[model samples]
Target: MVFWITLDPLSDLSRPPGDLSSGDLLNQVLYVALYCLTMAKLIDLGWRGARPLLHPAYLLLLAWFAVSAVLGVNPGTSVRRLVLCAMVMSIVGVLPILPRTQRDLELWLGTAAMIVVVLCYLAVLLVPALSVHQADAPREAGLAGDWRGIYDHKSTAGPMMIVFLFIGAFLAGQGRHLFGGVLFVLSLVFLLFTGTKQPTALMPVILLVSRLALRTRSRLLFLALCLGALALYNLMTVGSAVIPSVSDIVAKLISDPTFTNRTGIWNFAIDRFLERPLTGYGFMGFWSTDAVLQSDPLGQLAWTAEATDSHNSYLDLALTTGFPGLCLALWVVVLMPLLDFMRARLDPTKRGLALLFFRIWLFCIFVAALETVFFLRDSAVWVSFLIAIFGLRYLACYPVRP
Candidate 1:
């Protein structure tokens, strides 16, 4: 988590190095070594926590990814991205088994989260230019004064602090009340200053919904709540583009109905998606590509051709891997995580840990509505969500006591 977070700070992002992948030799080597160590540990544990890796949904998702790699518009890029993603998945797969008990799990994760929090604060205090966005910065100058806090963007920092809030809550509920409370307060204070309104607004509500989800114990109800949030958010943002009435309503409701010019991007992406709906351009292949940017030129109002992603994860998946890939992703990453959480919660002793992961999963999944996060190439947000995914799976598959 720390590696991903600190790997690409906002300062480095302002002046990105050429050939991002080739220059990332250190990351490649570290991932390989960690992958080997985890595999060895899995073997020592008699391959514990390996069942979910072989699930039919996960297998089909892999198969579809292979299909995308072979048939994608850019086969070379797809293959490289596929390999990197597999390495991350392998590490995520074995992580849950390392902790023998719930307390051990909390300690390891809490310590890492606290480290992240401390480093973020230090960046803010000692290197304000890097930690806080500048008004005169070449890019997104309008976002001046926002606290990114060691992250690439304020949006990224805000959601991550929200995840840490849940982690703190988990620790407190588990008997480390003083430490956990401190973590919670620190994260909350940091989040308030992130200058990203969406996550800040979702903070208290997420806490309430998560507690209610645990109390209700209805998987269907949980899905209803998540899908409802997605629809409301989409309706206000991109849905306005699909319906004239929605556009008019949104225009009346907000100062900028275009949602910072996202509607044009969404429309352009939709048109492209319609062209090759079955199989997308390729995994992470649609945007920022020479062929794509040069061909099917977007209109003036459209998002910059240099845009890294479509700003919507589900759309990015469909744009890259096709509609089939998106469906598989929904089943594999979305639905399956929900199922794991539901089953895991039934184990009374593991409920607290399970709830913590579930809460994180919900937030990431919801936030992805407006962000390209699901498989965005080793992003800290993606890593955090995967940890929640596998963590819940482990709790459901194995009964552990604190």
Candidate 2:
């Protein structure tokens, strides 16, 4: 599921790293079809005794969608977002009432983590390898020398793996240390090999925040040691004159104003949003119509670059649905952590789930500041479902003592 969701965005499908087989496209469509069918089946079965779409979160999400439908610049895009939201909500709706004990909670989370691992592994197998030119740039090989595997962008892979890594790390803390440690290590290695700088920068910030939020006994000490070790690791890998020094690499990263010209796109989006402060461009409105995109700052900076959505999600939302839309979405995101903290007191088992979701959500938002996040499916969607599930599930599991 993650593979299909990510492949389009990450692959260099422009030139395509490998052969362009019709079979490949067929397989991709089939994948989506199967996933949708499975979700539908699950919802169908659950409907016999499942909760209705009357939940508050469902209402809020639906209201937001209706607004987008009426006001959205691109009804098609707005509709797509709405459908995705509905699918996710359905998943949340079917979750069995909250687990009665800490052990039950662990089982649920463990199942999810295992599924993530399996999906990522399958992605590694399904996508074909493609060789990219390295004449002026780094001649890096993708999943396989030429295979990008499931994802198109090298950057997305890192964050995707980071989420898994945190999940694995939490599992390790729960006493499945050996298995968890291995999973964590694999995820970390995958992130490093991707060579994407954002995840490299974002992961530590999340890790630090998670430790503090979890209020672990040795959090401060752990953070200091980890930071020191990370510095040393960078010194070894990127700093050696024999190799690329961290300083040299970081300087190069900073010098690239575009970060692929995302910054310019963000600025353009902001300006566009300012034009429609109350209900900006209708959903998916900004990119479609010729009037939608007034200028291409990205095109001016680079020889040939595709400027799709604004690089930033916040800007994208404002551009699509206006300030109200953006604010509502942001509210959904901001409330996750506080909700997690509250749930943690009721169910200690939920602590791990909360920590994992919190970390992923935090990084998603951090990445969103620089990158438009919704074009591809991501952790944000999954975390949102988890938030709704546990929020309702916990309430059902443990009624108020009073």
Question: Please, what are the lDDT tens digits per residue for candidate 1 over residues 100-165?
Answer: 777788998899899898888999999998888886666668888778888978888998899898
- Winner by lDDT: 1
lDDT (Cα atoms) of all candidates against the true structure:
0.80, 0.54
lDDT of 2 at 73: 60
Shift in Å, residue 364, candidate 1: 0.7
Q: List TM-score per model, in order.
A: 0.93, 0.67
Q: What's the C-alpha lDDT at position 316 in model 2? A: 75
